[model samples]
Target: AAQTDAWDGVRALRADYRTATGERREVVLGDGTVLSLNTGSAVNVRFDASRRLVELLAGEILVISGHGAGSGVPLEVATREGRVRALGTRFAVRQQDEYSTVDVFESAVEIRPRDGSGAPLLLAAGRGAAFCRHASGAPHAVGAYADAWSRGQLIVDDVTLGDFLAELARYRPGVIDCAPAVARLRLSGVFPLADTQRILNMLPNSLPVQVRSRTRYWVSVEPAS
Candidate 1:
């Protein structure tokens, strides 16, 4: 039944996984690394005697390394920009069109730019950095509500309304446009990911914006009339 179907799904995604829009997925690698894929993400896993790697094809992922510091086989997550070698860590990687971002949560990681222009950065826990093919930016403290999506929550603390809408759009299938007039409005809350429409419905209650729905697949947040 459900469990059997779930296993079948896992087998199909072991080597390569591409989540449908609004869908999230989790996979366990042979070495016991746990990967949590965010909406619309794609990844491929490659493991050999000498190395274990996960290629992030699209979107974002949260990884918990299975191997310890003493383990001979190394675990790394690769994006188009470069590879993030996990130093026995828990971290998240987001592959954007122009650059890739990494947030170290538990231990540490080494960010190596694909072009190798500069020395690789050693990012410790509680820090994050963004890297392009040629360079990586200085590490910054992790955001207040970072990686909350992995736990089926979208926690916002004083983020702009536009930013919140952008994140909400990831878990939803349609376009959620926030008007410029309301884009800068401040928002802070813990919104559940299970029912995204409910989140939209409640937004007007807290903010001075109206949720205009042309269809379930299309929505607009406009300044209240």
Candidate 2:
């Protein structure tokens, strides 16, 4: 079953904020930083004299550095893999099971892996990087629509059905099985994420696939009969 509750216990006990499945929220920190929490996301905020830390316990978050009345303290977003220290920039950080990805939209950020073996890297604006506990990948160009989800939209460009569903699944509960038969079908659009079921129903209008639901919690996309 698909679920984002792995960090539920930690979130209940320590998280400063979180968003449920299919829900998006924005939070303002003490230092004037704005945090946009994506679906199924949880975070814990720790502000001290030395630094400001927003520990991502699960899912994704978009951070906009604030220039508020608070004192100047470095703001960082930490995942299980490593820490992303903001350089007076705007960025989004996503936490996955094996690695974490950072998309920098403005200014730059310093990525420091949890393990000491790999050297830290300075990623500039308009670039993205994926890093694990021990090493970081080379920065690559990223699309401007990286933060589209914050606006309750999913903008895909000629992506495979399987890939698209994999991302859509992040916003809902239960399994969204894309049968291999129809997985290769491509799609592109600006779909409203407010209603995922409506999005699923609209797929057949563009692709050669049919959506079947055994229950609200189980859905499969297969080749249209």
Candidate 3:
């Protein structure tokens, strides 16, 4: 956690995350693959005229298949939760706190929990899952988080405000405190990065809590009356 290099290998690099401002960077693996990293995210490359590998830290990222690599050429991601294997597809891997999510946009990926276990969990398109860091375990869904990054949209059914806020905070950096009184409230809407401020402004209209900004770098939810 002290001063150190956040990146490794020439194909991958880590953007600066020191200024409390989310940072993003791009990398082109030796195989002509393009990668777009998100805020507070970092990656390591594993390519040397043989295989292709990438590792992700926090935030979101988009991976496009690169050519000049053989069919079934391994495109793997290492994270705090475990290892993810891509299968001729586009995918995004996120590691936030104790939670790690893999959303496959195309094809499938095999997840081998960093538990050092030999077997792995297979994830197909349109389905996503979460892993618990302590136990090297994860849940299965039919790719629910599939389009979280590529599509830039979310489809939530009936869920508590607390759950929704917890999910929304993944995209934004820093703190987003929600009051207990309004955490149970339920609502649904679409929020894009371009309209994040609008989303912040709209929250107070429905709940009794006000969304106050602290220097625009942090936010807190508090009782309105």
Query: Of the candidates shown, which would achieve the greatest lDDT relative to the real structure?
Result: 2
Q: Highest TM-score, which number?
A: 2
lDDT digits (tens) for residues 1-225 of candidate 3: 122223321223333321112344566666767777765566666666556777664556777777755434787877767878888777778776566787777889888877655567888877677765433345456445445434555546567778877766765766788878878888766666434557778877776778889866587777786
lDDT of 2 by residue, 110-170 (tens): 9999994755799999999999888899899987678999999999998899999999998
Candidate number with the higher lDDT (1 or 2): 2
Error of 3 at 127 (Å): 2.7
Better of 1 and 3 by lDDT: 1
**Deviation of model 2 at 116, angstroms:** 2.7
Candidate 1 clashes between residue pairs 3 or more apart in a chain or in different chains: none
TM-score of each: 0.90, 0.93, 0.74
Pairs with steric clashes in candidate 3 = 126-142, 126-143, 127-142, 127-143, 128-143
- List the global CA lDDT of all models: 0.89, 0.89, 0.66
**Cα displacement (Å) at residue 83, model 3:** 1.8
In candidate 2, position 97 carries an lDDT of 75
Could you give the candidate ranking by lDDT, starting with the highest? 2, 1, 3
